[model samples]
Target: MALRGLPTPLPGLAISSLLLARPAIAHDHHGGSEIPEGQTVSVEPLDTTLWIHIFVNMFAYGVIFPIGMITKSRWHVPTQIVGSMLALLGFFLGHAHGGREFVGNNVHGLFAHILQILLIAQVVLGLYLKGHWEKGINGFIRKLIRPCHSIIGKAMPVLSWTQMIFGGITALGFCQGEYTGQCAAHFIMGSAFIAYGILLTIILLVGQVWMRQTGRSQEFYDSAVIAAWGCVNTFTEHHWGTAWVRNDWQHTSMGIIWWCAGLAGIWMSRDRDGNPKRNFIPGLVIAITGWAMSSHPQELMVSEATHKMFGHTLMAAGLTRIIEVAFILGDKQSLTEDGRTWNSFQFLPIFLLYTAGFLFMGATEEQMLLVAGSDMDHVAYILILFSLASLVFLFANMLVHMYDRLANPTSSKEMNGYTGVNGRPMEEGRIRDAEEFELEGLTSDGEADDEGRGMLRRSQEGHRSQIQGVPLR
Candidate 1:
């Protein structure tokens, strides 16, 4: 199961890479009448400079920086330094691109300015932290700025995600007047699904200890978020004092189900003794929503087929989630005794949600109409979208595994029954190594008072304990 499920997202990437290498079909003009005036369709391929910029920044933000955030190895500093350099280079190429010019005030361009400023600030803070000042006003300033540096570093990837989305919208000239609401709904919801999948991945891989500490089942948080989102959707999806359209009715009903199911899920998230427990309400809600969406009315055949596929994919996600909980995991927190190993079937729901997100995001009315005009069938289009999903998932897993490797350098040998020079398991050696690293950084002078040393040791131990579960690699 692991072998089959793990490689699912890779074929999409391989196929999509080959497909993308082909020259884009040229259209005299963008096909849709809904296209806002002066907005250009992506009929032509992007300029070489823009393509280079996109890949460089994607590698930096999507790959390099994320791994850097999760590791505490000697390589962390150099990794971040390389990522920073690449980001700066990407920023330069973005401005220097000589492709077709945007006609209006470009949100992508405007947002780039803000992102660049944040990047510069992050780099400066990193330099200060690395400087390791421990005397005078410089030390005081560094202490004050340390937490801010960590916070900003963590936030950079999310901001980069938004900026990257804006870049795509800018290139394709989407999210304009009248289309803004649909565009926002599709993209934001799609991103939400993808984010949810990532969270699940994190938990499945290295979050078992954190889960135990929470004292609440994962469903508790999941249901709480669902209920909150449902409440917002129930009100915002339809305009007050206006006759409800078919879409408004359908959307509102889906929201109603979410909140109703969510409340039930939250209620069932714990056993009688107050211990965390699993429930099926969230997965049921997802399946029902998909069922409703599958038959969504659409004028174009392409739109109809695409919507059905999206709904089916979503339905698969929900059903697999149910299977994983009810059958595979038997409603337990984990399948393995130590909460380290997971059944491969666990990945089914995750990747399905991921695929469904891309499908829904790509099934927008304008995008569908465009595909229809280009003589492309729904199957081919959906496959291409799946390819994109697969590529993103592949990157996500790679980042997680890289972090696991760097953070628990000796875990593999320990798993294979190797002992270190001290006749201790390599896991113990890893903890000792980490303690020494932290002590070296925290205590500027080689010698510290016993009290200070004890505090630092406790702090390092606490940190290590939190992440002591199995490494994803």
Candidate 2:
């Protein structure tokens, strides 16, 4: 038999009641339950506030999604959609669980939060699919699109920073008398956002400096661009997880490590005037240092859970790095008489190595999680690691092929004696001789037919006599 009637919690009323009841229980002391005690919980009012913030943020993100679509950068479009959805989820959760006012009720604050999500999403998508996007777009569109994209792209990171600033303002204003623990969490996450924002700015500046110092070589420029993107991607991911306290720091650190490795790789491959090998040593050091630092036990002492999470992240990052390095090595250019050929097959070993490392890392993480009875976290780690591994493998293979094609030189057309645009080559020596003779004829003849004829005859005779070493008649 169906139950005749069951009472369900009211929205704002329930929350207000709980808030009113919380202080009374504070003195009673069962050490407090997971849910805050005390408060005259009201349902309707709190629900209204929650809905307002949710609606505004969603509206802002909705605007951004269309903007992304119109731009036609496939990579960015997906991320925009995904981020919007995530923000929507966050908004709903905040309202349902009671913390809507902490996000602010003002239109401006809502706009800023939306902008923040949009910018972060764009940066992540751009970096993750950098090379692919560059290749996927039509050549004409690439040329037409890139300038506009660059301007907007450059502004995004700065906009993200601004959004963070506004978020801080909102946090301060809204959280004043609210839940202290939640407020503290917001503050910490906000700080991470700020830090990563600064890092992204620095990465852009460093790329500019590297470009200025290295000249306009495409390879050098592309490498720097890739590295800069990597930094932005790493930061974006960290920010995505910031609201969730249980995120693995090791994963964030590994991303940072990859960013630094890319930077070092770019620096190493730059054309130095002398002793280029010296640069390689330093570059290698930087890469190794990044990996070591990322995997270090700084947060492990905090808890066994943190240690396992961090360890999994670091292992995944390291394996990914190895795969990248392998691709680079396999794509090394080899010079031949016909031109150059890239023996990309050389990377096969490294590719296998990466696969093995990824498998081993995944297994180790699973084992650790099993021992700790944290299956959910372990599963998350495995998924992330697998996703990254698949990406690395796919890209590495594609890059190897691309590098080979780029390195292989095509034969130039043979020059014919005749001259025309896209037709035949005109010899400079022959052209100059003809010009000189015409000038002499014009100077000597001076537009008099008979005189010009006589001068031409004399010139020919003199030239012949000089060649034969005898007087001409």
Candidate 3:
């Protein structure tokens, strides 16, 4: 009767079957029907102390050590050396701090970390062997170090790539984490450090290879000078936002220093001969442009009342221009007659480009200031000053060119022999005679022709007479 009231029970649905089905339906409802398989476990975060230690180690070993090897200033050497030592100390401290944490938290990771450290140490040692410890009592030590240094030097590119991969993995993990502030900072700083390390490694390798190829260890020093200048330029330009963080004094001072480096590099690379006048025009233009870009006062967008300035920009521009011009002139002066003409007008194109590019760049800066809600007065003032300076330099160069052209219209065709100061023929009669003698295959024995013979005999007689007149000791 109960089955009839239910209107039908399935043939397989007995009381036991119904009871078992109830439990299965309950399990499904409670999400216990199936278990997930092969899920990935999350990696634990690295200890903060360990991270900091690694950061410090990287800065010291990767940055400071390489810099010391490159820079060689008598006055600054002690300070740099001391700083490098301090960085090394910091590296060890950080490594110890991190190593302890790594040992406790990540037994397996500890070996990988150690391997990374060892590789980095190898690179640092190689750099030291190649530069800092190349000479003196440690020379024998260097001999032993050379094979390792060579191996590491070759492997640097690989190491750099590995670092990048690790850094990217870390960054990805950080991005996925809930600690937004800490993770973001970690990701940013880590990426930046990795990038910097890669660049440093590349620069070191390049410098080493360059030294080997040129057989000029001094070239490494020269590259260091360029790097120093670049750093200064970067600081002045506030490339890393240094200007925003630091006081004007710091930026200005740094800018000056960087300009000096550029100037020094230019001076060092100069052609041995002097004649900077022609080169000066282009140099002046570039200098003026650089100055306009860097130091000319422009109102800040955030604060119209405040002005943004970078003195180093102008200083670098000026010094670089002068140096470039001087080098050009020097090169021109040293050229053979055939090559001199080729180099003569080289400065002209450089000047034209400088003038055009700077003019455009300055104008762009002005527009940027305007968009930033800066006061037009400051912009106008800067524009005027920059334009005036540029014009003055341009006119001065033009005047010099005009004067040169006027003084010697046929200067180019004349094999650069038309010196305005001295209209005397560049090749004297003696030089012409020597050239003619060589062309004619004549000996100074009164032999080629009657005229040549007479001239040769007369020259001999005159020389003999002069010698005879001088009393013998």
Candidate 4:
């Protein structure tokens, strides 16, 4: 499913080429120092300090910042402050590393500086917005900055994700020279998987209304992107003037299938009346891609194992998506919603995609080699990636839940012990209560009046018999 060894539009490829083009004898004022022209540098093993820095920063940006944004209240301030402090500490630790001495302009370090500046700007904006000024130019300025603050707040986590990927690659000194193109393909496509999973979760949790308003099935958007990406992959995967190798053929053919399947998906996403309709073409395409990737030949056993797991996870994601759309949801959007609760079965595919993304990202040759050199086996490495995915999945769900709680606060009915989806109260005893009182006001004609009188008389007779102490059978 990836371009394998083709160049991409990402800037990382250029930076990597610069880093690997020359030897590390002298530092390039702006770029990092290079290794000797013919000498090769082995991948640097991660030390305890580096690991700590990674975890601290990942937690701050991935967990705390997202939660802060979701809260968007007084709690937001403190949560972000804590996250910022942790991130700052991680930044310092990154520079203080002794295991790897990156000379000249370190890509990871440069990105960190940019990230920190953005973080500072975000904090400043938040503080200014908190002042609550009014009736002055300050108020107007605040109004202008409010949206900017929110936009930055939302963008920080995504930016942090990019920086984190940079850190991983930089730390290992991987993705250089010929591997740069492959790095771009793996990271870009992996991030796409994660982004898709997140988008689906958002739509499942809180965007149902917006989705319904779009007047198009979810598959429409999915197919559109797939088609667009496939078009790019088809043209760029192989150089037109060069001899087409096996890898190029595989990649280009996969791209061909993607665009073909995507078009079918778009066409089937509507009914005869032009109403939105669900289709499984997207899922089927994903499954076929996964199958191809699982059987893809690799030079190393470690790589083979990693790719197999990644492919299996992807296959599972696609299959689960099909099951969710076709069986669980009956080819519909969603199920009955008395509350903002999702069917338990719905999360399976999202989490699988998340895991699949991590697996694919970790399957890079350098990363697999690192794993092979470590004490851990492929199974252990895979499990660690799965664990990371689970944590991310938890954070995503929690953030979405926080947003739902804020967007749809408790109503008077809910405050009085009634609660359900879309702020509607539960209908537990409503029907029985309505039935019991239904005939009370029906006194329109003779038959109705006679029936009512007969009921009254029978009640009176029963009371009299009870007063006489007689057993009325």
Could you say which candidate leads in TM-score? Answer: 1
Which of the predicted structures, 2 or 3, would earn the higher TM-score when compared with the native?
A: 2
Q: List residue ranges in candidate 3 displaced over 4 A.
A: 1-51, 62-64, 67-317, 320-473
Q: lDDT by residue for model 3 over 377-435, one digit each (tens)?
A: 54565555356436533543443343333322332233434533355433334334444
The TM-scores of all predictions, comma-separated, are: 0.81, 0.31, 0.23, 0.78
lDDT of 4 by residue, 315-360 (tens): 9889989998999988777675343456899999899889988888
Ranking by lDDT: 4, 1, 2, 3
Clashing pairs in 3: 287-317, 291-314
lDDT of 4 at 272: 99
lDDT of 3 at 153: 40
Query: Which stretches of model 2 miss by more than 4 angstroms?
Result: 1-100, 103-150, 157-473
Winner on TM-score (1 vs 2): 1
Clashing pairs in 4: 23-34, 23-35, 24-34, 24-35, 338-421, 339-420, 339-421
- C-alpha local distance difference test of each model: 0.73, 0.38, 0.37, 0.73
- Runs of candidate 1 exceeding 4 Å displacement: 1-45, 411-473
lDDT of 1 by residue, 226-292 (tens): 8877787677667899998777777787778788889999999999998899999889888887787
Q: Model 2 lDDT vs. the true structure?
A: 0.38
Count steric clashes of candidate 3: 2
